[model samples]
Target chain A: MRLELVKRPQHSALFSAVSPFIALALTMIAGAIMFSLLGKNPLDALYYYFIDPLRETWSLHELAVKAAPLILIAVGLSVCFLSNNWNIGAEGQFIAGAIAGGILPVVFPHVQNVMVLPLMLVMGIAGGAAYAAVPALLKARFNTNEILTSLMLVYVAQLFLDWLVRGPWRDPGGMNFPETRDFHPYAVLPELMPSAGRANWGIVFALVAALILWFVLRRTLKGFEIRVLGQSPRAGRFAGFSASRMVMVSFLISGGLAGLAGISEVAGTIGQLQPSISPGYGFTAIIVAFLGRLNPLGIVAAGFVLALSYLGGEAAQISIGLSDKAARAFQGMLLFFVLGCDTLIHYRIRLAHSAPSKRTDVPQPSEPAEVA
Target chain B: MLESILITIATAATPLLIAAIGELVVERSGVLNLGVEGMMVMGAVTGFGVTVTTGSPWLGVLAAVLVGAAFSLLFGFLTLTLVTNQVATGLALTLLGLGVSGMIGEAFIGMPGIKLGSIAIPILSDLPYVGRFLFRQDPLFYVSILLVAGVAWFLFYTRAGLTLRSVGDNHDSAHALGISVIAVRYGAVAFGGACAGLAGAYLSLVYTPQWIENMTAGRGWIALALVVFASWRPWRVLAGAYLFGAVSIGQLHAQAIGVSVPSQFLSALPYLATIAVLVLISRNRRLTMVNTPACLGRPFVPAR
Candidate 1:
């Protein structure tokens, strides 16, 4: 008669595996509610929004074009996020990389060699890493908030590009517009299958990078060190791994990858450095990284799914008169729902002032942990 | 020239100072609410809508505080009650805030703002240099200064602030010492939200006297940077905000003076200044480790 029933949170390895699926389900349910609020037929709208677009060959290529950078950036970001070193300035790095990578093509316009393209790629990666180094140095040296440093640096990078496009990088012959000269034919990335739309070697790079990162994070000594550094700096220190050094290295790697993505973008698709080259791919990749739980392979899959939403958003916009802004709102909604569900997974909910007077009865039972 | 630049700097500093000081408090109490942008935009829209409806600037400010605080409560609920990752949750809140604010703000695009009037001083207004410098400014500017001073006092002098700081520095230890870490964080978050709202309201009602899409445009992010530059001190936040505001408005002065740099480069000035200042201040690890909130951006989950 005195037996007490204990209420404990359920923890299974399977739960971790299913979290993203649950989050996606929640997102769909929320999307349905939003659609109904807008007076649209939820199922029909959903079908057309996601499926109708995929049936198109052109749309498939566009999805690849969009997902290419996202996958590349998110893969790199997984490394940083897993190490617990946030580099929110990937957007800046991306911008800088584009400027740097595209510089050769725009400046030389006549460089007609295979080696030129490879050199441009290297330059782009270096450019992004250099830009990223600003925050990384400040972080490693002064203990500045990397999130802010990196973010603030984004505007600087952006304005610098704007300045370049309108000034030195401006095409003198191309009628007063703020864009770089067209990229050389040699600079362009060859299509994968010769006719797969925008699907090119960039996707291949993303996949390869994801695999390498996955291997490095899951099955390597450096990976183990990064995990330890993120989880506990004191422990990392005891293990003789310098936190600042890791911070620098992680930032360089992340920035360099983002740079590579930026160059790949300019060379692969648009073939020029245009203002607003990315639709916030660097920022969106943050969501992709977290949504896939920071696993490289998981991020690769997550990148495609998120890319679908972007494609589907455009589809809905054109068909149902939904604005591009609304599509952005939908993306934001997806991120929000995923975050909300993530909370549910990590912590169980409790009803306050209800039956069963336990610790969960009161409010704010779940709170943040110490930095350590 | 100096007078105009000084005025521009002061005007520019108002909203940012409000936000940075507010973030200082939020960070002090163990939360990194990156949703400042979202809260500010929501405040801007809510404030604009209220001002348009009631024709009262004061009510607009009040509306902003309410909306911002309400939005911030979402952050509190998630990190405090939901035990979510603080960084991820904060990012989500910012994105959600931006989307929702943008949606709500669509109605107010291109609307004219209600301009706030200044208090005319008698003697000080008549003086040459000191007159314009010390007197003849709007009530909000003065209030913002007082708010900074008040915040500085409250944070350092009051016992309540001690508890808040204790909670931010080490919530678990404070919890063991009989402090409600959850409640303190809630208070800090709400306060931060209100401040962000005030910053937003200032934008609509005073800064430009109109509502536009994404007008805050990284200003919230700038305010976040200012907090780091200020080293979590209220007075330092005021100084940092003014410095940044000066940098923002300096481009105008430089352009007017016909500086050789391109306008785009001039626009990049404030961002460059922010990076430079962050580097200067953050390089001192011992100082940073001491000044920065021990639990800044960390989520706390109580054991069962």
Candidate 2:
């Protein structure tokens, strides 16, 4: 008659390790049902979505390309989320990074030097960090909710980028289209290997960032402080850790990485700044961060898995006429299952025929409750 | 010109007021659902799709409310029943809504929608400058106003409102007092969803009268912020929504008038105003603390 979640004395480490796979399996089942409802062959649709993308060498390279920005952003987000700082405006930060990094090539087109690429990277990092500081400053100084402020800034950043590409930064010979001029050879991120595919240094950046973050999170004193602060702010304060400072640090790291991802996307893949540079990579990274259990190395794997879904979505669209919305829905389903499975890891579901009568023993259900 | 501008502002503010009032009640009941945007979009698509097919705006409005309520039920299951992380689950609901709506709305894109026409109240509608702006408007506009007043009275005067507020203020205390915390929260979330859906329907049936992918854009998010800006008060939500509506429409006027500012800057005005208001309000910590649901965003688990 009634169902309840009873917290476990200790979460099973084995289940925690295996939960993502269980979630993935459940999502696949749900996706199959969805495809059937859409009047498509579920097996063929699933294959195109989950298998066809990885069959080609070129698609594999494309997977890496898409995964790079996701991994880079998710790595930073993992730090922020782990430290109890929610930075939902990574999309804005990414755009700001792209804008900041593109300034050199867009403004002084004649500049040709080896320093251009390095300077652009620095600008991208600084731009993202500076943009992130808005919410961070508000949260620290005025106690404004970072979740809302950070999210609100995303719209501002998006509109700002739109203005730049349409008005001032529009390419002179672009036929009045909303986009910036393409970067010169010196400014562009070089390909990792011309013979293989279009994959570039961004993936390399993602890997290195993941490695560095893993070390910092697992081995450093600062990492311990972040963990302590996240678990209990009161205890963290007693241990001489400042919540305000941690907010700034986590935001800067997250924002800077997100910015780096933005610039890398422009310099490496897009080659020119446009009204829409990302296909929701910043937002998708939030899913990646959670899927990875807020672990840097785990995020690397989660990033690739999500990237595969994008490729699969495209593949399904071509093969079985799947709508882009279906792909997004599938991703959403994956996140839901992931959260659901994670809940199971922490609490066991119990069904009781009769409701309890006392407050001390599993607070009594007033009536028969449905499972939603 | 001023009257027309006022009408436009009122039209824009209507959906916001409806949605924010719903969220205010939900938040007051101690559940924070960030899926407003997702629910709104779902409402928009469903409302548009149904109107296009059924040829009746009322049916479309009804369909949207049901869809919104259904969508919120998913959130209720995950948060209240499954006891999942509220923030993550809410975000998931949003992603699902956007994706599912997009899929369902693919065929409806570019199709003209049936409008929910304005109601003309004879003499009241014919009054000089205030006539059309106040009396002659879409049925939903009046409903939004009534919603504000009704919610304000219910929250302040009704016993059910007090119970909901108590449940939100401290779930543990409310639980001990035999209040069905989960049931009250489910109702609150469902109400929020219905309001969000109605807002979305207003967009498709009255605002634009056509389906566009992500047509709700970020208004759902803006609605969420408006709740905080209003500090969870129904009347304050009305003022905040109108102010936001003015800022949003004012930016377009500025662009049309060729003000020195770039159109993009003007476009960002509403969001900027939200941040500014948040900063100003949050500066007075006492105000936020007093009104903010103490159990907001926290998972409620009954112990044995």
Clashes of each: 10, 1
Q: Candidate 1, clashing residue pairs? A: A142-B282, A142-B283, A367-B299, A367-B300, A367-B301, A368-B299, A368-B300, A369-B299, A369-B300, B113-B209
Model 1 per-residue lDDT at A194? 66
Tens digit of per-residue lDDT, candidate 2, span A154-272:
88999999999999899999999999998999999988886888898999999999999999999999999988888778778999999999999999999999999999999999999
Off by over 4 Å in 2: A357-372
Per-candidate TM-scores read: 0.92, 0.97
Interface RMSD for every prediction, one decimal?
5.4, 6.6
* Candidate 2 C-alpha lDDT tens digits along B1-304: 9999999999889888889999999999988898999999999999999998999999999999999999999999998888877777888988889889999999998898899999988899999999999999999999999999999999989999999999988888998898989899999999999999999999999999999998888899889989989998899999999999999889888999999998889889889998999899989989988888888877787755
Clashing pairs in 2: A362-B304
- Candidate 1: misplaced stretches above 4 Å? A1-11, A35-45, A193-196, A352-372, B53-56, B121-135
Question: What DockQ number belongs to candidate 1?
Answer: 0.45
Residue by residue across B249-287, what tens digits does model 1's lDDT show? 878789888999888788877877877887787677677
Best by TM-score: 2
DockQ by candidate, in order? 0.45, 0.57
